[model samples]
Target: MADLNTQHMIDEIRDNIQTGDTLKTKLVLAHLPDVDMKTQNRLIYELSRGDVRFTVPILLYLMTEHVSIVDELPVIKETLLSNLLAYPELLIEFLSDTSIKDKTHLINVAGELRFEEAVPALLYLVANSQDEPEIKLIIETLGLIGDPQAINTLTDYLYAANRDLIITAIQALGQVGTQSAMHRLAERMGTDNEMDYMILSIFADVQDPVSLEKLNDTLASHYAHMRIYAKQELVRIGAKAVPALIDNLLQDDPDFVIHTLNVLGDIGDESAIMPIRKLLGKDPKSANVRFAAYEALALLPLRKGAYTLTAGLTDPEDHVCVAAAKAIDQNYSEILTAGIKNLLRPKGDEARHIAKIIVSAQVDKIFLSLAAEDFFQELSLVYLPHAHKDTKEHYTRLLVKHGFDEFANKIQGGEDVKNLVKVVAVDDSRMILNIYKATLHELGFEPVLFEFPASAIEWLQNEKPAMVLTDLNMPEITGVMMAAEIRKKYSPKELPIIMVTTQNETNDNEAAYAAGVNKVIQKPFNAKSLKAAMDEFM
Candidate 1:
């Protein structure tokens, strides 16, 4: 396929390369663009098979000697690159060569080869270079090499003045995936949320022992989004995180145990079932702890000890009782059914309270088992009208499932909320929203309840509600976070936000206050406390 001029040019270039003729090499390469593309490719094809131990240096020299020439004969650069990859040791040697000023491609090839031997050369470029893009590429190449020797240099960049550099170093260290590398990453958790979340993601993907330990430790963090991210990652980790979570149950900290229980419950591993039950046997008095434990048990199949769930009907807190009831509903047995029936049979205050729990829990089988009871019917009708819309639909489905269409229709016809004072309440829990539905209605205001805070936030942008009630520790956005967004439009006097927190730590109160919360009320709030907290702001 070689034409006369192209073959002559290739022969001249080969002759120049063999004779070590520098000026002639440059002269021959300069004529590359003057010829047709076929001629240029032919020259490259011939040079690719040439003796590159001497020939490559001449090409490198030409590359150094040129702006006009390299742009004119770009194929010379391509030919050099092809040979560099073809001979990898030569690629590493070229990477180490201080004479080759444009070693960007060389560094990239070393990384593609994952040549650990090239780290010192790459580090030398990192130390000498200040250009962000070139240094970033070099750092990334170091990460692809994943050599431990680069860890210290990468660690230094974690606190770089440039955020992009910081992000790059984090990714690089994550790719390193050594124990010390993970420890360095774990040390950066409190830097800021964006960085912390990125680092946590690395830990999650790395899944080494140190990374797992760091993730486990983050469960106890106070920041809602951070803790939520950790809980999600741990549950995603599932069985691998079980041993650590199970060990967490023995710890003295209630908040720590509660968070661990929440993750384990979502993980739904059977091995955790007995350990959790044993944990419950210690008579953990924190209602939040009991609620988390039972919530977790509801997700796991507790085949042997399911009847024990009915005992939670006697829990001092309504939420925990609901948790226990749901757990019993999921692992339903005749013995558990009889246990629940006996617990609600007396029809006294105790029976009324337990029936409310069962209704709120919304277990189809348990609700159906007691559907014919007059006491259950009376309480169900009373609460059904004001229950959250979804809860109402859920029970309506249950009622129709068992030939109680008339009763279902009755609750479905509950009072209209369109005309009442529109007070918006944002919480992720349907159970809590149901409580808001009844409590806010009783307090003489129509409750616009959202099981999703984002939906509530979107609704608030157009219409101004009388007030907004939010809860901390939601999945994507916390109550404090939502309050901050609302405060951007309406001030404390213009629009009031009442932050409902399960934990009453002073620092959390400060965060809510700083986020423009009008009042901070500790949960489990009732109509009385909620109205009192709202009274001051109103």
Candidate 2:
């Protein structure tokens, strides 16, 4: 038997359900905990009769909080499903409601049901609505529906002025994941716009053959940014893109072929080996294509490719030779040892060139061998101090061990040269300082390295070095300010200052010169440039 209070609560809920007021329905729901199970069952049976007004809240409560009610009153489950399916207008009407909360709840219901019948109404709302939250949810619901009819509607919003809506539309199209949808996304990549990266990411996710072909076409795009975006997407697509990438390599376009080679290398798939080798055998005249093929072959790591890489060692282009040698160094170090032994024999220039390639790459490692005496003599013809200090020391030690005492002494004895120039060098990057250290020592100057410009400036007050090398960009004090402070005590002739910077700031360069800097060298400089700048003053 139900208690009188429970009976009264049931009567009040029934009246509220009849009134069809959301607030009254909520008030009835507030008293549900105090009601008996019989009263709860009575309330569910009364409300389960196709009442669209209580449909969302009841379903939300049943789905979230009162899930066990489905087991107790199994008819309620069937009723909720049947009512939602029978009356799609209820959800459609909720979509136009002013409350975002109510609209969001109905959108979730539409997605949960995956009701294709609701797609037309959802599309209508998305087309007519300018509210971001409503449009976002509506577009999201269409993605969950994944009906073909929604594709054009979603694609139209891809170029919306609101970036959030555009991104949401892109994601929705990715969820659609149809070939037509993918082609639509790929069509936007022709322009070098801000959306290229986002489009590339979508392509990477799609990974369909159509998307692969489109991305390959982008590799030949005149815009470098578009080509880069395509290349990165191809690499990200990885082995899935291998077949299409190989097909593109066969095209007559040299630029496309070269970019395909690089992408194939980055993918590092062995399947590209034979095709790349065929290209190398044909001996394409373009050094770019040849170098790209060499790099791709190196990454593939096939034993037969060693001959081609070795042939590249004698190529006229220094970059090609270095690329081939680095490939051998990373993948085939033992080949270098064999090449060194071949140098000992009375081989032709090919053998000597191969030996030089091996020595340039593995100079620190191979110089330790007894056969390195001839190689060391060959290396001595050029100053190879671009390596770090520890590597330079190792190479110097190897030269001394192999009986090139005079050559080794000349390199290691650079400090004893007449009036050994004391150069103060400051940079925040330890890597750059190490490069400077090796370059300065090679140029026969003692470099005083400081990671901080302030400390370098303080040291400059007392000691007068032959020159000061400082980075234009520093944390504590910029190179220009430090040079200005140094100019107060000494003239540019007395203390020549060289400023190295990575940024191409012509105005800053002018300012630095005005602040007493003798010369400014841009970053990515080599030993020759550093030596040239030092020779200008020191």
Candidate 3:
């Protein structure tokens, strides 16, 4: 207590804290550790009550340049963070001070505070810093700050070869959560599944109309799992997704329309019914879309015009006709039955066509809906005996199961597909598989269909059919993926694979051919196109 040098230094530090002089304060803080604990604590308390601006920088200086001072006063660093956050302008000044080299701790403070004012300094650090962890911290701080200015820099990091940087930048952009930030995220899709899925989830969280549109656009992505993930998110978005999805129908892209229809159907929003009906009325050229529409209609409740569904019974494509029959059975109408009755009265091609529709639609609801009609039942009996055994047995059992034992007994069992050359086809959509069944049979080949790629691959191990037709966008193992597996056991010369897809992009075509496909054909395929492609390998 009587030491002159130490007592004089403590007096100088006290005067510096009271005077709010930065240079004088740093000079005095340099001697702070030399004082006793009681004197240091008293000086720090005075420093805390000093000018806020002077207190922050003086504390930063002591912490950065005087490690012993910080060790002697442990609360000094936490106090520095507290003051910097409490007065963000001071945080910005401290952050912008490049002369104080180690700013990782301060950059974290800026991020944690989401200090928007600190963005410029953070950006400066981002541009100047070579340290990855520090740069990552700056990127995160900018995102947390959510200034529009940071988007360009954040997007630049998206292209970085470092996966961690790319991932961190993606997350930061997600935190920014602006329309521009989400747009930047969307642009990074298709680099890979993990990133694509990450972007999708971000869009889901943001859930703006723009994000919804971007999510809708992913339906057209060449990758199947991405498309699947997009659909799941859209479905999860529910009725809120209806307007944009309805707009998707107006676009000429039928593949996009088909996916939108699938999501809309899963959502089952009643408002979507009219838009869907309007799409159907436009007579979309894609049978896949038509099948999807009727499939959706089967799930939706019909309010007024259930009778209009009977028109599908006469659609030239068996797939469309069958889907219509399923929709009709779900919303059973005497009016629809009568409309179908009038169509069947000629009891010739139309009568036989309705019978085939009921049998192939395969639900007992549609079958029983028309079973009481003499002409229809009699006509179905004629074709039921000759229909594919699976179709026949399916109807027979469902008929018996639903208490239509009499009609079940009347369907003479089974048509032998054994005589036809077996052609393997894989598509996730049951509607598409049914189309393959009828189309392949007409070409004098038996169709063995798989609704999953895994099952198709497992079957390909033991059973190599004449040729395989697989949809390009099946879940998990895409058409290209399945083609690669099949190529392992069988050469293109040994077995031809045709990639059936709604989207005919050059990248997908190139990838499919690289995976050992014999041909890549676009969908809404007909007997003519299907046969033309099939005959090449035959």
| Cα shift from native, residue 319, model 1 (Å) | 1.9
Among these predictions, the greatest TM-score belongs to 1
**Each prediction's RMSD to truth:** 3.6, 9.4, 5.3
Clashing pairs in 1: none
List, residue by residue over 1-538, the lDDT tens digit for candidate 1: 2344766788898887777776776677777657777777776666666676656766676676655667767877787777776776776677667766777667777888898878987898899997898889988998999999999999999999988988899999999999999999988778588999999999999999999999999888877778779988998998999998899999888878988998898888999999988988887978778877888898898889888888888887877777788788889888987887787767778887887777666778888887877767776676777765667888888789889887788887676556777788887766567667667876878789887778887887888989998888788888888889888888889899988766665656788999999888866666788899998877
The regions of model 3 sitting more than 4 angstroms off are 1-88, 158-166, 185-197, 220-229, 401-406, 413-423, 437-448, 458-466, 525-532, 535-538
What is the Å distance of residue 529 in model 2 from its true position?
10
Give the TM-score (vs. native) of candidate 1. 0.88
Clashes (candidate 2): 0
Residue-level lDDT for 9 in candidate 1: 81
| Model 1 score (lDDT) | 0.81
Give the TM-score (vs. native) of candidate 3: 0.80
Work out the TM-score per prediction.
Answer: 0.88, 0.62, 0.80
Q: Cα lDDT for residue 34, model 2? A: 56
Top-down TM-score ranking: 1, 3, 2
lDDT of each: 0.81, 0.69, 0.81
For residue 230, give model 1's deviation from the true position in Å: 1.6
